[model samples]
Target: MTDASDRLASVRAGLDRACRDAGRAETPLLVAISKTFDADAIRPLIAAGQRHFGENRVQEAQGKWPELLAETPEITLHLVGQLQSNKAADAVALFDVIHSVDRPSLVAALAKAQAAVGKRPVCYLQVNIGDEAQKGGCALADLPALLDQARTAGLNIVGLMCVPPADVEPAPYFALLAEHAKRLGLAGLSMGMSSDYETAALLGSTVVRVGSALFGSRA
Candidate 1:
């Protein structure tokens, strides 16, 4: 089998095991992040039944996904990167899910964009779980406020998304996000990556964004 299929199979099997261990009857949605990789690189994964894909940039995804969407209209596209408030309209036009609603301005922008475009991509409030200064997520202290603002603005806030401090063990951060989700009664936790999906799954991630592992090292 081709490399992408082989890797996808591996991740699926691993996710299955993780769900079993966690006593969860359902596996989190596996969103293969196809940000920098082009169609040629992504086609194999699609051929192998990867229906959900994630991209971080508006222009980059705009440059590519239209034709792919035309080819496979059933595919679900996720915007899993930092979304600029101004690009809300562009993102709403293209993606099916937006995983970075972190601030009031973005919340307002997304609400307006959805009303104008007549398309409402599912939303997630990104929490700066690590409280890292350079990260794109809102500070942990601001999560509830952002959630309220996002919901009031009419963005369909489905759950919370986070990127923990790089190189840390990650479990604690994942658990923290889970705690927030549970407390808020939100059902989605968009966490984990190629390296830590198993742990995230075990801790109740309703969706996981995976890259590199399926597409191979971009480097």
Candidate 2:
């Protein structure tokens, strides 16, 4: 079998076991992050039935995915990076799920874009769970109000997303994110990555973004 297929099987098995352990009846969607990887590298996973894919940059995604997407219409593209307001229209047109709705300005921009395009991609509010300065997420203190703003702006805020501070144990942060989502009446938690997806799944991550584990080292 192909390397991508082997890796995909391994990750799927791990996710299944994690869900069983957590007693979660629903399985988390595994988004194979193909940010730096090109279409040639991603085609194998698609051939192996990987429907969900993630990209970090809109320009890079535009550069490649259109042709690939025309070939496989079932593929779901997820924008798993910081989104600029100016790119909201392109983002709305290209992606199926956006995991970084962090601020009111962005919410308004996305709302306007969705209205103009008549396509509303599922959005998740990115929460700076660790309060890190370099991350692109709303402050924990600002999340409640941000949710209100997003709802008021007519964006479909399905859930919350976060990247915990790097190099630290992510369990606490994942748990905190789950609790935060639960408290806000949000159902989806877009947490976890190559290093700690199991923990995130056990804690209730509805969508896990995994990159290197599926595509090997990125360029």
Candidate 3:
């Protein structure tokens, strides 16, 4: 087996074990983050039966995925990075799920774009769980308002997402995100990454954006 295929199997096995250990009934969507690697590197995972993939940018995904997706139609694409209002149309047209809806203006742009393109991609509102200045999520205090805005603007909000402070124990943040989603009547929790996905699955993460753990270190 190729390296990507082997890693893919390992990640899948890990996910299965995590779900079993946590008594999670349904399998969380494992989004293979294919941000920098080209299609050549990604196809092995696809061939290994990885149907869900993630890309960090619309331009990069555009450069690589169109041809690949044409060849195989079942792949689900996720936009897992910060999206600009200007790129809303392109993002809505390309991705199946967007994991970075952070603010009201972005919500408005995405609503308009989805309407124009006639694609209602599932959205996850990013919460700045750690309140980092360099991050791109809405503040925790503002999430309710942002969610209301998204609903009023007619966006299909699937869940909440967050990047906990780096180098810290992410369990608390994951728990908090799950709790918030539950309180708001949301079902999905798009948290976790290569590092803490098992813990996230245990904490009710419906989507796990795994990258290096499955694809190896980026160049």
Candidate 4:
């Protein structure tokens, strides 16, 4: 197997171990974070059986994914970054899942886009889990209202997504997101990344967006 395939296998093993350790029966969906990598870098993982892949920008995905998708039509493309209201229509038309539904305006834009395009990508409401000022998620205080607004606006919100504060034990934050998911009747928890995905899986993340661990360090 190629180096990329080996890394994919290792990550899968780690995920399986995390599931066993957590006593969780189902493994979280591993959305390979393929933001910067080119098609050549991605095909190795796909050849090894990876179906779900994530990109951070609509424009970037547009420039890179069309040809790739034509090659592999079964791939599930995810938009795992902050989305602008203006790009809502393109995002809905492109991504299979969007892990960044944050504010009311974005929520309304996405709803309108979906209505116009007739394609509703499953979404996750982003939470500022660490309460950081520079983050893109909805404030903890605003999450409930935003979620309600998104639902009322006709968006299919399936879960909560968060990027916990950097350089800290991420367990509590992951747990907090999971708790909110339960309390709010949300079924999916779109947290975790390359650094702490195993911890996230143990803490009940329904989807983990992993990048470097699978694709190797980006240039």
What are the clash counts of all predictions, listed in order? 0, 0, 0, 0
The per-model lDDT (C-alpha) reads 0.92, 0.94, 0.91, 0.93
Preferred candidate (TM-score higher): 1 or 3: 1
Residue range with the least summed lDDT across 10 consecutive positions in model 3: 1-10
Candidate 2's residue-wise lDDT over 31-50, tens digit each?
99999889999999999999
* Candidate 2 accuracy as TM-score: 0.98
State the TM-score for model 4: 0.98
Candidate 3's TM-score: 0.97
Candidate 4 lDDT over 71-169, as tens digits, reads 999999999999999999999999999999999889889999999999989999999999999989998888889989999998889999999999999
TM-score: the better of candidates 3 and 4: 4
Residue by residue across 1-219, what tens digits does model 1's lDDT show?
A: 388889999999999999999999999999999988998888899999999999989999999999898898999999988999889899999999999888898988999999999998899998989888898999878887888888888888999999988888999999999998999989989998999999999999989899988988886
Candidate 3 off by > 4 Å = none
Candidate 1 C-alpha error for residue 93, in Å: 0.4
What is the Cα-based lDDT of residue 140 in candidate 4? 83
Model 2 residue 45 CA deviation (Å) reads 0.2
